[model samples]
Target: LTVGPPPTPIPNPQVVATDFLEVNREELQRWVRGEPGAFDWSPFIQHVCKIEGRGEPWQEKERRLRGRLRRILPIDVHCADPLGAPLRPPADALLSTFCLEAVSPDRAAFGRALLNVGSMLRPGGHALLLGALGESFYLAGAARLPVVPLDEDDVRGALSDAGFTIRDFRSYAMPPALRTAVDDVQGVFFVHAQKPLEG
Candidate 1:
């Protein structure tokens, strides 16, 4: 978290985050500008610092993060250029958590979504993706959104086809106690992959 901002080695680093929905983008902007009704991310930051056993005060870390966040733009992961317009040169890395599967209706769409989002990064850039494996359909409020059931092989194949070289792939099974009828999420997968040097 203390690393310099992506694609930049300069001292004044900044983060450019994006969301597909205007509402979501606004929410982040609200938080970034400290508007009313903004969520407090202090506890989450504190927890992460505790886990990392870092000596730096969590408040200091939070300040650094807020300072780094300069923009919250809109993005469409299904589009060729997710950001729709040029913001800056390609980023060095991206981190996605439980997004592509939730937005995609099927396996093919999932792969396409990955490729689209990955396009935002420069060649040889890396990605840390955390997503579900097997057993689809997650409950968002009263709505049950369909998810493409994907296993280890499916993820590997999709990454391969997308031109990502998988550095590591880890899976964690759903514990019985946490499993519920609301969502049939069988397991979760975490992958650290890198694109080729030449785009």
Candidate 2:
């Protein structure tokens, strides 16, 4: 879901809906225009679609994604304040990438954010999280943004405390060449977890 407000001011609720869609459409266009192999999002999208029993041809799927992106704006909810945003009923699954790590200043904050995210899920719901592991900072445009360095153990403990059961977890070490190219990120972690059904 695309949470938070649009880049520009929205005069009204209706305008908020429209502006959010426009902003997302522009961002998706920018991503699609990047060099080939710059981002391999298709496979991941396909996998999710397959699991949801909505798989389609690559071209069709891409078109659908573009169409959906242009029409949908999930500005109704924010991770830190899900209830305040009035996200009712909860979601069956959630996917977050590099968000909590970028915004959280420390391990405790990360854990809190994780709990907040878990609260958005229905019981037995799944979550896929990808974040930079052991990263203190990353460059954003011209400014350096602080990141909360978290390890596998920290993530596991946080998920468990958040009422989630670990289903899959993987980490990748930063390659020497890529390590110096951008930030001092030691590696990245990919985690798939589920909220306990009993809870």
lDDT for each residue of candidate 2 in 50-69, tens digit (9 for 90 to 100): 88785566667665554544
Best prediction by lDDT: 1
RMSD of each: 3.5, 10.0
lDDT of 1 by residue, 155-190 (tens): 899899899999889999999999988889999999
Q: Model 2, residue 13: displacement in angstroms? A: 24
Best by TM-score: 1
What C-alpha lDDT, on a 0 to 100 scale, does residue 8 get in candidate 1?
A: 50
Name the runs in model 2 displaced over 4 angstroms. 1-57, 67-80
Error of 2 at 46 (Å): 9.6
All candidates: TM-score? 0.90, 0.68
lDDT for each candidate structure: 0.86, 0.71
Displacement of residue 182 (Cα, Å) in model 1 is 3.1
